[model samples]
Target: MSVFTLTKEHLDVLEEKKLKSNLKLIEKIIRNDDFYSMDQKDMQYFLRVADVLYRYGKAIISDKEYDDKEIWYKENHPESHLYDVVQSDLRESGKTVKLPKKMLSTDKAYSKKEIEKWLDRILNTALNLNIDRDEIIIRVTPKLDGYAAYDDGSTLYTRGDGVNGQDITRAFKRGLKVTKSGKRGLGAGEIVINKKYFDKNLSEYFENSRNIQAAIIAEKNVDDKVKKAINDGACVFYPFSLIDNWTGHYKELLNDFDNIIEKIWNAVDYDVDGVILEAVDSQIKDNLGSTRKFHRWQIAFKRNDEAAEVEVVSVTPQTSRTGRVTPVAELVPTRISGATISRATVHHYKMVKSTGVGPGALLQVVRSGLVIPKIEKVIKPVEPQIPEYCPSCQSHLIWESDHLVCPNKSDCPAQTENTLVHFFKTLGNNDGFGPKNIEKLANLGVKHIHQVYDLKSHQFAMYGFGEKTSKNLYDQLQASQNIEIEDWRFLSAFGVSRLGGGNCEKLLQHYSLDNLFGASVEDIEKLDGFAKVSAEAIVEGLANIREEFFKVYNLGFNLSITPKLSEQQDSSSPIAGAIIVFTGTMLQGKRGDMEKHAKSLGAKVAKSVTGKTTYLVAGTKVGENKINGAKENGVKVLSEQEYLDLIAQ
Candidate 1:
């Protein structure tokens, strides 16, 4: 019934190997979110279309997205990848040039559980091969979200479907630089551009960096801007070995994931979607081997983020509390995962212009975790669309660089409406006052969290909600007040910039919610994790929210006091202060979580349970010879619960 379906017509097109049209229709479906919403047949349609498109240059989504969707479909249907790589499509990829050394796709893991599974495989490997787990090293690198390519001294080739590619040596002649002194060739790498630089200089001219990359490889002439960027060295061919990384044994990696990822994500100025984790063991590599698609020993740990590509059917302006006019993109209805998506937002008008996001433009919507995915890339360009006035408040909108703000913040209905909604969403204690309910409340002159909380039974019907819904909303307000909540969670509910769940927890760990109002920028920044800029904004933001914060804090709802730094220091014990490393596979407990728990007690826990390791906690799969070696070196070997009991003491 929709514009595209996976009918015999689509299959015939697929069978015929019609790439351009296949991509066009697939893009249309993905852009509309229709591909994900279809029946089994239609799901097959868009997925196949996406697969074919990825093999070509014009990907409907990303390689990460394609692989993820393929895996997802395979999990549900199990018959998916069967239709996966048709032999005919393989030939289109070109003759199988045995990769300089077969470059296999990284095995993927969606969660920590899957990571444990990987570790389990490694343990099995050590047991079978008579290897020492302590000697095994694990390495993690940021997976560059860019075009995959391989260079062999003379030729720069696309990682064409993972093996065999057309020689794109001209990309180098076009002046593409090697990232961080990456020389002519050391094997496989990626082509990427600095995100911040692209945002500033080239976005106005190019829709997305992918386009520029495509141009660099196209048989046609290059864009002057692309040439300039290459000349300026903003874009480059980055070898994986040249990039920044985090390396340690498996136990240490599991113990310090958040810290490690934060470091790796900021390691490069380019776009990075996930971290690539691989074992640095030749024996493990040979023993574990690989499949037709991926290597069993190496895995890419990617977050399951939601993303969509939608049309800017229209840009409707709405005023914010700060009088900022945020542009809302009303997309043509589509579905992602299982949800029908029709609306999304842009950061500001400045983002609108520099990013080339306008009416009829195709934009990539990658949701930030569970939150909405902002426009990360503008795929197709159209004439720029500028809103003359705020759609809701009917006030003239003026620009502040990338953002258009309304001067009517004092009385804009949209601002007042969204503000009210933010308060309820932030509290997260009671749920009845969601968007629909709060919108009703705002229309009836209920503007603030306090006002909504103070509502009477009759106030619900006054706002036009049904009697039942009204009473429930009122009860929800009371229930929110009654629920025990944290000081930081309560603070984050207000959605102050730079102050979310993590920062809120960090701030509360240092200062009480009561004292935060008076905390200076210097005072806030003194705490760990609070950078100078965020501290300044948070201090200023807290001052602005003081009246409301006090109003709610005075409500006397149950609140959990975050343990202060002083208290944590006092509770820290010296016995808990040893840096521990786990060696050999533990038969009794999980190596990953055990290290984390050890670190919690002020002990610096480690991977590769070693000679210097304070405690070599042995488990079932641990080798006796390895444990004896550790013991001979004076490392204490604690049994599973014995280590637990030690920590308990």
Candidate 2:
């Protein structure tokens, strides 16, 4: 398929000779480097350059290439700006037209995993807001691939840069009819022609619909074919709402991901790159809210459109400060995005061995939206190279799963340094514990977390740190402790195996900091979102950290306690602190009303029954599953009359 390309004049207009030269450099580098392979950096740069051209009405790649490959790139580098940028609009026409309404980019999901995560979030939000899960409805529609414009009866404005857009009323003036029989000013819409119409009628005259679209909105006279196409009723403005869609409750959707996608994908006459899925309730949408770029309640899933294959030049093992010999692929320098990348990480020697990620191996790499390109798939296999010794300490290595482990855990200088660095980084509210200072301190025998904290302002100057730096370090330490950090963050600073920030927060929310020291593996697993394996690891890890953990805990750090169910159990109300489960249908009120009443009484009404369930209330037509689940879990299953009677008493 024909794709857009850049001209010397366009490049010159942007004063982007460096980018042009870099593309040549990338091309030259690819010849030397293995094709089907690239470091994250090269893939990243290539994506930026390619996308920049795409935004300028001169895409250098096809939709397929851009989607698949670029999807790979974005998946790898989610933190990249391209992953975060509002891609639906590419700063249309450089004119920021005031929108009739704020047309926020929909929250996006690329895979079912993310979609499920979204579902969970919606469920959690319902629980928080005291709403019934069954009542939560979601709407899925085709995300039209065309110029985004908003209409307010009189004016049509491009969704230009989100806030301001260009006046594109000319398309309407040029006889663009509304889809369906809807009147003018139906909010957001896209300028589109029927795919069948484009192929049948306009294929001979225009290269692509996108090019033809540009011409239709131009200030100049429209082409005869375009005019004829317009007269033919093939081209029209399709409003987003008027687009066909699928709507259902969460469970139905959870069971049928493909059916939902395929139906929405084939819904519209316009070209669609992805599906737009969002919760339909205004309350949920408001609670979820939008970020600076997109709505949190909704998302448009767009796979990337760029990918390339390059060879893995070689796997070079380098020791981390932790003494783990990470395998880095030193590729022949290639350009991706705006940078020159000669190296990309291969993660570990295990990946090198299992996936045949080695010299002469062809690897498919893609730039993540705006993130560093990452190795996605190995297209060709090669002999693996496993390092037997730690690259830093030269200690004998051991196997940890697929990883060739550096067994020098305790005294390994790399591990010690990294551990110290992790400590300071996790503290979060401090400066001067960054790599440069920590490296200097570690070199001077400051290996432990307490040892670093014990240093005086004057002692830092003795370590050759400037006096100013030393005082700042002292102040940062003081400030870190003074800040009212959550108890979980304090524990997370230790970097326990299963105690990342999120887990720490989750655990703390269920139990007090002091109580956690006494928590068993079983106790931890009882909490929601925790599995037995992770709980076991956390229990063991916390045991190891208890000695050191208390030492730090005693340092007068400001820690806030996480409230608990037991503490709030007695409010003299009907449902406070009770683990209530609702079942069957109700007549006095909708199931929604009963759930809300329980929440108002401060009760934890869970979706599923468990051993800890305080009361399971049955209404009418209560299923055997509800009864069996409550009985199996050892919960008190009560009839609607019995539950009401108990609550009254």
Which digits, one per residue and each the tens of the lDDT, describe model 1 over residues 139-158?
88999877778888888887
TM-score of each predicted structure versus truth: 0.44, 0.50
Q: Which stretches of candidate 1 lie over 4 Å from their true place?
A: 1-44, 52-68, 75-98, 304-649
Question: Tens-digit lDDT track for model 2 on 1-649?
Answer: 0112345644752354245646553343332322123444456666655555555445554343555456655654343556434243444445555686877766666678888998888888888888999899989899987767899999888776666688878888898888887889899988887899999888887666876766767777998888887888877888887989899988888798888888888887788879988889888877776654567778776565444676778888765553356687766565555444556667567788889988888877665333334576789999888888777667666554445545443345657776677777767678678877777888888877777778899998999989898899888988888887667668877756557666786787677788887999789889988888677667755665576667777888987654454554357786678999888887677775676567556777665555567989888998774586466456788888787776777
Total residue pair clashes for candidate 1: 15
Candidate 2, residue 132: the lDDT equals: 95
lDDT of 2: 0.70
